[model samples]
Target: EPEVTQTPSHQVTQMGQEVILRCVPISNHLYFYWYRQILGQKVEFLVSFYNNEISEKSEIFDDQFSVERPDGSNFTLKIRSTKLEDSAMYFCASHNARGGTGELFFGEGSRLTVL
Candidate 1:
């Protein structure tokens, strides 16, 4: 079976520093997304990417946040400046198609900690 993979499973950074989380989604999947969970809170959608462009984005995905498929195999999320509130578990997700049973494959998540 295939699954999404994330790098730097855990990261600790100072406030105002840049952070980049990396992921490798399933090769066959067509849609990619980035989500986050602030400790003890509901999962929040950040952004969705497809056909090499952003499909949709939440307000939480402000100018500080960006997502990219730099190559055919890797997807990445970058935060230009980290804040105390930015600490959370960032997840990478994917689905092969859009109109199915709404099943999504998710990565283990990269935990970000800002001091």
Candidate 2:
């Protein structure tokens, strides 16, 4: 079955440095999302994209954070300036247009560590 895939499964960066995480979502899915989990914290929603535009975003998705579907297949999240608090596992997820039950298929995630 098709699945979401992410790169740089683990990364360690200094605070204030730029970081970009990449993902390739399922081919047929129409909606895409980015979520993050801070160590032992609950999962938090960052943003959602559909039809090439941001459909919704949470406050956690500040100006420093941005998402793009640069080509037809890759979805990416860029943190213009990483912070110590930004250390977490960032997940890329997607779902089909049907939207039944709002199930999301998620990638294993790219772990970001800032010091």
lDDT of 2 by residue, 5-107 (tens): 9998999999999999999999988899999999999999999999999999999999999999999899999999999999999999999978577689999
Expressed as tens digits, the lDDT of each residue in 1-115 for candidate 1 is: 9999999899999999999999999988999999999999999999999999999999999999999999988999999999999999999999988577658999999999999
Deviation (Å) of 37 in candidate 2: 0.1
What is the overall TM-score of model 1 with all chains considered together?
0.96
Q: Which 10-residue span in candidate 2 carries the lowest summed lDDT? A: 95-104
Candidate 1: residue 23 lDDT (0-100): 96
Model 1: C-alpha RMSD to truth? 1.2
Tell me the whole-model lDDT of each prediction, alpha carbons only: 0.96, 0.96
- Model 1 misplacement above 4 A: 98-102
Question: lDDT for model 1, on a 0 to 1 scale?
Answer: 0.96
Position 40, candidate 1: lDDT: 95
